[model samples]
Target: MIRAFANPHRFMALSRWLAPACLGVGALLMVWSVWQGLWVVPHDDYQGGDIMRAMFVHVPSAWLAMASYMGLAATGLIWFVWRHELADMAAKSIAPLGAAYTAMCLATGSIWGKPTWGTWWLWDDARMMSVLVMFFLFLGYMALRAAMETRQKAARAGAILAMVGAVNVPLIKFSVDIWSSIHQDASVLRLDGPAMPPVYLTPLLIGGLAHMIFFAGLTMMLMRAEVWGRRGDVLIARKLSGA
Candidate 1:
């Protein structure tokens, strides 16, 4: 199945329609989740009025931040093992988007923390610091990829780096547990199920799913654009060589 879509032509054909469909569904979900989270939901009595609502965006973006990098690592593995161009393209496309999400997570978490943790930032917190490191890794991957003179060289370098950096993913996930961090413990993915009430958890769930769909759509579109851009470069090179 992976090999089937390894063909760029097949990937492009499917993504052309799937991308838009995912985008539409993602937009609708975003609207619904935002409404459910911001207006419809009641404020947490413990967490300072409505300010706690930032969790709707903060938590979801953080999840996507980590999840997106994991996707990058997975594709990187495929490319390294199989030398699949589409997988390499997908990993390349994920770098910026993952970086953006990680940055947003840090920013929003800072905003949410100001009210809840009484500070804009917390260097002592394990979860917070680990995520910052993850964002930096994303930046490093992008830089390394761009610095390479050839796509083949970039792919090999990127794949190795992505796989090595993936060690941080599990560290980020378990940081709160490993250390006495100020960040809240895992509530959503607990073995006992979500600790929050259904009312609060519902919008969070919607937000997470919405972000996932949006990420998928956006990544596919970016991959398609990258493919087209590279093809144009090749054509120009050929024309110049002929001339």
Candidate 2:
């Protein structure tokens, strides 16, 4: 499957339709889920209450922050091993989006924490600290890639860096369990099944799906642009050399 997408023609053909389809479906689902969460679902009786609504964005952003990094690792691996053009483009394109998602997750988490915990930020929480590190890794990868003069060299460096930084993904996932943390344990992804009620869980699931699809669509569009942009650069260089 990875090798199949390595072919540019196949990738372009699929992305032409798939990108728009994903964006459309994702946007619709997000609207529906937000409406359901805000207007339809009853507020929690606990301290969380209506404030928990932030989870609609916070949870999905956190999940995608991890997911996008995993994608970066996969594409980076493909580029490192096979030197596939599409894979390189994909890994590069995903970095900024992953960074944006991570930032959103942290910001929204702080917003929720302020009301519930009576504090906007907690330096001691393992989960919080780990995710902040993940965000910095994204920034570092982008900066490192940009500092190189040649795209190939940049890609090589970025791919290696991304793979190495992937260690943070697992840490972010299990940080609450591995160390002392105020963050709640996994509720939606637990082995015993979701710990939350149906009313809250349903919207959360939809929101997660929406974020995943939107990220896919956005990533594909960026990959397509990178391919074209690279081709244009090659053409310009050839013309200049001829002149």
What are the per-model numbers of colliding residue pairs?
A: 0, 0
- The list of candidate 1 runs beyond 4 A from truth reads 168-194
Best by the lDDT measure = 1
- The residue-by-residue lDDT of candidate 1 on 39-95, one tens digit each, is 999887666678878878888998999888889999999999999999999999899
Q: lDDT of each model, Cα atoms only?
A: 0.86, 0.86
**Candidate 2: pairs in clash:** none
Candidate 2 residue 77 Cα shift, in angstroms, is 1.0
In model 2, what is the error at residue 206, expressed in angstroms? Answer: 0.9
